[model samples]
Target: MALWTMSFLLTGCVIKQHQSLSFCETASPIYISRDDVLTQETKRQILAHDVVGERVCGWGRSNHTS
Candidate 1:
Protein backbone atom coordinates (compact mmCIF):
# COMPACT_ATOMS: atom_id res chain seq x y z
CA MET A 1 0.00 0.00 0.00
CA ALA A 2 2.74 2.43 0.93
CA LEU A 3 4.71 1.63 -2.22
CA TRP A 4 1.66 2.10 -4.40
CA THR A 5 0.90 5.46 -2.82
CA MET A 6 4.47 6.68 -3.32
CA SER A 7 4.51 5.55 -6.91
CA PHE A 8 1.25 7.30 -7.62
CA LEU A 9 2.56 10.60 -6.29
CA LEU A 10 5.82 10.35 -8.18
CA THR A 11 4.03 9.43 -11.36
CA GLY A 12 1.71 12.39 -11.02
CA CYS A 13 4.51 14.88 -10.67
CA VAL A 14 7.18 13.65 -13.11
CA ILE A 15 5.51 11.32 -15.57
CA LYS A 16 2.41 13.43 -15.96
CA GLN A 17 4.48 16.45 -16.88
CA HIS A 18 6.07 14.73 -19.85
CA GLN A 19 3.03 12.84 -21.10
CA SER A 20 2.16 15.78 -23.35
CA LEU A 21 4.93 15.43 -25.88
CA SER A 22 3.23 17.93 -28.18
CA PHE A 23 3.10 20.48 -25.43
CA CYS A 24 6.72 19.85 -24.62
CA GLU A 25 7.76 20.31 -28.22
CA THR A 26 5.55 23.32 -28.98
CA ALA A 27 5.34 25.22 -25.73
CA SER A 28 7.98 27.77 -24.86
CA PRO A 29 10.00 27.50 -21.69
CA ILE A 30 7.77 30.07 -20.06
CA TYR A 31 4.80 27.74 -20.43
CA ILE A 32 6.58 24.65 -19.21
CA SER A 33 5.55 24.97 -15.63
CA ARG A 34 2.76 26.83 -13.92
CA ASP A 35 4.30 26.90 -10.43
CA ASP A 36 7.22 29.28 -10.55
CA VAL A 37 8.76 28.19 -7.27
CA LEU A 38 8.62 24.50 -8.06
CA THR A 39 9.80 24.59 -11.67
CA GLN A 40 12.30 27.45 -11.75
CA GLU A 41 15.28 25.14 -12.11
CA THR A 42 13.54 22.93 -14.66
CA LYS A 43 12.67 25.95 -16.79
CA ARG A 44 16.20 27.30 -16.61
CA GLN A 45 17.70 24.01 -17.71
CA ILE A 46 15.28 23.61 -20.58
CA LEU A 47 15.88 27.17 -21.78
CA ALA A 48 19.64 26.77 -21.66
CA HIS A 49 19.53 23.55 -23.64
CA ASP A 50 17.19 25.08 -26.22
CA VAL A 51 19.43 28.12 -26.68
CA VAL A 52 22.54 26.04 -27.16
CA GLY A 53 20.85 23.59 -29.50
CA GLU A 54 19.41 26.40 -31.61
CA ARG A 55 22.77 28.10 -31.85
CA VAL A 56 24.50 24.90 -32.87
CA CYS A 57 21.82 24.03 -35.38
CA GLY A 58 21.99 27.49 -36.95
CA TRP A 59 25.75 27.30 -37.17
CA GLY A 60 25.59 23.89 -38.82
CA ARG A 61 23.08 25.07 -41.35
CA SER A 62 25.24 28.06 -42.29
CA ASN A 63 28.59 26.28 -42.47
CA HIS A 64 30.22 25.80 -45.88
CA THR A 65 29.51 22.44 -47.51
CA SER A 66 31.91 22.73 -50.40
Candidate 2:
Protein backbone atom coordinates (compact mmCIF):
# COMPACT_ATOMS: atom_id res chain seq x y z
CA MET A 1 0.00 0.00 0.00
CA ALA A 2 2.81 2.46 0.80
CA LEU A 3 4.58 1.65 -2.46
CA TRP A 4 1.37 2.22 -4.43
CA THR A 5 0.88 5.62 -2.79
CA MET A 6 4.45 6.65 -3.59
CA SER A 7 4.04 5.61 -7.19
CA PHE A 8 0.84 7.60 -7.51
CA LEU A 9 2.52 10.71 -6.05
CA LEU A 10 5.49 10.35 -8.35
CA THR A 11 3.25 9.94 -11.38
CA GLY A 12 1.32 13.05 -10.45
CA CYS A 13 4.53 15.05 -10.10
CA VAL A 14 5.75 13.88 -13.51
CA ILE A 15 2.45 14.73 -15.16
CA LYS A 16 2.44 18.20 -13.61
CA GLN A 17 5.99 18.82 -14.76
CA HIS A 18 5.10 17.76 -18.31
CA GLN A 19 2.09 20.05 -18.33
CA SER A 20 4.16 23.05 -17.18
CA LEU A 21 6.85 22.36 -19.75
CA SER A 22 4.32 22.08 -22.58
CA PHE A 23 2.78 25.41 -21.61
CA CYS A 24 6.20 27.04 -21.61
CA GLU A 25 6.98 25.57 -25.04
CA THR A 26 3.79 26.96 -26.58
CA ALA A 27 4.17 30.07 -28.76
CA SER A 28 2.41 33.35 -28.16
CA PRO A 29 0.21 35.09 -30.73
CA ILE A 30 1.81 37.39 -33.31
CA TYR A 31 0.36 40.54 -34.89
CA ILE A 32 1.60 42.39 -37.97
CA SER A 33 0.71 45.63 -39.74
CA ARG A 34 1.74 47.69 -42.73
CA ASP A 35 2.50 51.39 -42.82
CA ASP A 36 0.82 52.13 -46.18
CA VAL A 37 -2.76 51.73 -47.37
CA LEU A 38 -3.69 48.07 -47.63
CA THR A 39 -5.77 46.91 -50.56
CA GLN A 40 -7.73 43.68 -50.82
CA GLU A 41 -5.09 42.22 -53.14
CA THR A 42 -2.35 43.15 -50.69
CA LYS A 43 -4.20 41.47 -47.87
CA ARG A 44 -4.74 38.38 -49.99
CA GLN A 45 -1.07 38.30 -50.94
CA ILE A 46 -0.05 38.55 -47.32
CA LEU A 47 -2.34 35.71 -46.36
CA ALA A 48 -1.09 33.57 -49.24
CA HIS A 49 2.52 33.70 -48.04
CA ASP A 50 3.94 30.53 -46.58
CA VAL A 51 2.82 30.25 -42.94
CA VAL A 52 1.81 27.57 -40.47
CA GLY A 53 -0.76 29.32 -38.27
CA GLU A 54 -3.87 31.48 -38.18
CA ARG A 55 -4.05 35.23 -38.94
CA VAL A 56 -6.32 38.00 -37.72
CA CYS A 57 -6.56 41.64 -38.77
CA GLY A 58 -8.26 44.69 -37.34
CA TRP A 59 -8.60 48.28 -38.43
CA GLY A 60 -9.06 51.68 -36.68
CA ARG A 61 -8.83 50.21 -33.22
CA SER A 62 -6.95 51.41 -30.16
CA ASN A 63 -7.02 48.39 -27.85
CA HIS A 64 -4.15 46.38 -29.34
CA THR A 65 -1.16 45.30 -27.19
CA SER A 66 2.31 44.07 -28.07
Candidate 3:
Protein backbone atom coordinates (compact mmCIF):
# COMPACT_ATOMS: atom_id res chain seq x y z
CA MET A 1 0.00 0.00 0.00
CA ALA A 2 1.08 3.58 -0.52
CA LEU A 3 0.82 4.46 3.18
CA TRP A 4 2.90 1.48 4.20
CA THR A 5 5.58 2.27 1.60
CA MET A 6 5.80 5.90 2.72
CA SER A 7 6.22 4.88 6.35
CA PHE A 8 8.94 2.41 5.45
CA LEU A 9 10.93 4.99 3.53
CA LEU A 10 10.59 7.53 6.34
CA THR A 11 12.12 5.16 8.91
CA GLY A 12 15.59 5.02 7.36
CA CYS A 13 18.55 6.98 8.79
CA VAL A 14 21.66 6.60 10.97
CA ILE A 15 20.45 4.95 14.18
CA LYS A 16 19.01 7.65 16.49
CA GLN A 17 21.43 10.30 15.22
CA HIS A 18 18.71 12.77 14.32
CA GLN A 19 16.85 12.36 17.57
CA SER A 20 20.05 12.48 19.57
CA LEU A 21 21.16 15.68 17.84
CA SER A 22 17.83 17.29 18.49
CA PHE A 23 18.10 16.33 22.13
CA CYS A 24 21.60 17.75 22.28
CA GLU A 25 20.30 21.01 20.90
CA THR A 26 17.32 21.43 23.21
CA ALA A 27 17.98 19.41 26.36
CA SER A 28 19.94 20.55 29.40
CA PRO A 29 22.99 18.74 30.68
CA ILE A 30 22.78 16.59 33.77
CA TYR A 31 23.92 18.16 37.01
CA ILE A 32 26.12 16.33 39.48
CA SER A 33 25.84 17.10 43.15
CA ARG A 34 28.87 17.19 45.38
CA ASP A 35 27.14 14.97 47.93
CA ASP A 36 25.70 12.43 45.52
CA VAL A 37 27.30 9.01 45.22
CA LEU A 38 28.91 8.18 41.87
CA THR A 39 28.37 4.55 41.04
CA GLN A 40 29.95 2.96 37.97
CA GLU A 41 26.70 3.09 36.06
CA THR A 42 26.09 6.67 37.03
CA LYS A 43 29.58 7.64 35.96
CA ARG A 44 29.15 5.94 32.62
CA GLN A 45 25.88 7.76 32.02
CA ILE A 46 27.42 11.11 32.86
CA LEU A 47 30.35 10.46 30.56
CA ALA A 48 28.12 9.44 27.70
CA HIS A 49 25.92 12.51 28.12
CA ASP A 50 28.90 14.85 28.06
CA VAL A 51 30.51 13.10 25.12
CA VAL A 52 27.36 13.21 23.08
CA GLY A 53 26.78 16.83 23.96
CA GLU A 54 30.31 17.69 22.99
CA ARG A 55 30.12 15.92 19.66
CA VAL A 56 26.70 17.20 18.66
CA CYS A 57 26.49 20.62 20.30
CA GLY A 58 30.18 21.44 20.75
CA TRP A 59 29.83 22.02 24.44
CA GLY A 60 33.07 22.32 26.47
CA ARG A 61 35.03 23.42 23.42
CA SER A 62 36.91 26.72 23.78
CA ASN A 63 35.23 27.31 27.16
CA HIS A 64 31.66 27.27 25.86
CA THR A 65 28.79 25.57 27.71
CA SER A 66 25.39 25.35 26.05
Across residues 15-59, which tens digit of lDDT does each residue of candidate 3 receive?
674534477658655767666799999888887887787777777
The parts of candidate 2 lying over 4 Å away from their true place are 1-31, 34-36, 50-65
List per-prediction Cα lDDT, in the order shown: 0.52, 0.47, 0.70
Off by over 4 Å in 3: 1-21, 61-66
Q: Candidate 3 lDDT (Cα, whole model)?
A: 0.70
Give one clash count per candidate, in the order shown. 0, 0, 0
Answer with 1 or 2, whichever has the higher TM-score: 1
Between the candidate structures 1 and 3, which one is better when assessed by lDDT?
Answer: 3
lDDT over C-alpha atoms for residue 21 of model 3: 46
Worst 10 residues of 3 by lDDT: 57-66
> What ranking of all candidate models by TM-score puts the best one first?
3, 1, 2
Clashing pairs in 1: none
Q: Which stretches of candidate 1 lie over 4 Å from their true place?
A: 1-38, 59-66
Per lDDT, what order, best first?
Answer: 3, 1, 2
